[model samples]
Target: MTTILEAKHVNKSYTVHQHEEHQILKDINLLLKQGEFVTIMGPSGSGKSTLLYNISGMDQVSEGSVYFAGEKISALSEKKLSKLRLNKMGFIFQHSHLLKNLNLLDNVLLSAYLAKNSSKEVIGARALRLMKQMGVDGLASHNITQASGGQLQRISICRALINNPDILFGDEPTGALNSSTTAEIMDILHDINAAGTTILLVTHDVRVAARSQRVLFMLDGKLVAERNMGKYNKQQNIRAREAALSDWLTEQGF
Candidate 1:
């Protein structure tokens, strides 16, 4: 299988002043294969979100490079990057960020509109199918304000999948949900990955990270370690994962 995404020694820094720069990431390398599900784990300020933004081209890197499907993302123009993001990548955030005025069906179809790929009739059918798969089809006529947190999250997921992206990036996807809802969402993501979409998820939740096929641990703006989650149960997996994380944290004196 071909690699769908690659990050080569990617570095990023922020300038708080004219001469002061804060390094947020250093020599970060990552490669994601088709259908692979990887999760990034870290404490606050670990540069997890920054890495996602850089990979997604929402933020520019200060050094190194990002490539998607063998094309260097850093070399692309903003318009080209937007096109790539619309057609090749899907995103799920901690917040829904749904359009308040659009009905659930329209909200999901908006992704197709942004990609400029399908007619209204085609997108409407696709959106309804996605909503049904997500168990939100019954709420298609409802507005964002009318849905529950879980329902809205499901709708957001439907919106993300409307474009059939090859790669999915999720930031704290289950952070705002109850335990049951979290499990539901996780199961849904697992099913999606099983259906062959590459997934890169960032989260502080041990349970969520434990479910991934691979885990990357980060601290102090760098990737400190990685672990394989092949056969471990959630308890054993999280314990081992956190131990590796704790060792890295202590080594860095963080």
Candidate 2:
């Protein structure tokens, strides 16, 4: 498989008052293969999100390097990095983070408009297709307040896929949803991964992690364990996978 992203000896630290350093992420190494679905799980303050940010180039590593598409992204300038993120990567946060003033369709089209790699007509068509695939096409002109939490998240997924990104980075994407809604979102994400968009997600829910092909456990800023669950199939027994993962996580002291 092709390596789409790689982190080498990555470390991140923050300087508190009086120049005292607070190390957040320890020496981390990881590689994300193309079209793989991977999840990261850990207790709060375990630096799970920090590792996601560093590898996605949303935050700079204090030491070591990150590479995307075989290029050293950690060494790139902010402008170039921003462009790379816009064109090559996609992000879905816990919150929808939609603009209150814009309707759902416009919000989905926002990033594609900024990217400018294609005409408005082309991008709009693609955005509409994604919204349809996500089952939010009917809510196109609706205000943000009018949609349910699940619908808003589906809209956000539409926005993330508007650029046809090589990889999707999700930070607790379903964290705000109810169990049923989380399952729905996970189904959509599973379909997306099956359709060949690489996904890296940070999640605490074992149900969510079970849908992924691999799960990495973090502890005190270090990756302590990983479980390869293999490809997810709707026809298979999901509860068994979740139970197995729960057992392994227990072994890892999670």
- Cα lDDT over the full model 1: 0.86
TM-score of each: 0.91, 0.99
lDDT by residue (tens digit), candidate 2, 109-198: 999999999998899899889999999999999999999999999999998889999999999999999999999999999999999999
Top-lDDT candidate index:
2
The runs of at least 3 residues in candidate 1 whose Cα sits more than 4 Å from the true structure, single-residue gaps closed, are: 231-254
Q: Write the per-residue lDDT of candidate 1 for residues 1-107, one digit (tens) a residue.
A: 79999999999999887889999999999988888899998889889999999988888999999999999998899999999998889999998889998998889
Candidate 1 positional error at 105, Å: 1.1
The worst-scoring run of ten residues by lDDT in candidate 1 lies at 229-238
Compare the candidates by TM-score and give the number of the best one: 2
Candidate 2, residue 111: the lDDT equals 93
What's the lDDT for all of these models? 0.86, 0.95
Prediction 2 global C-alpha lDDT: 0.95
Runs off by more than 4 Å, candidate 2: none
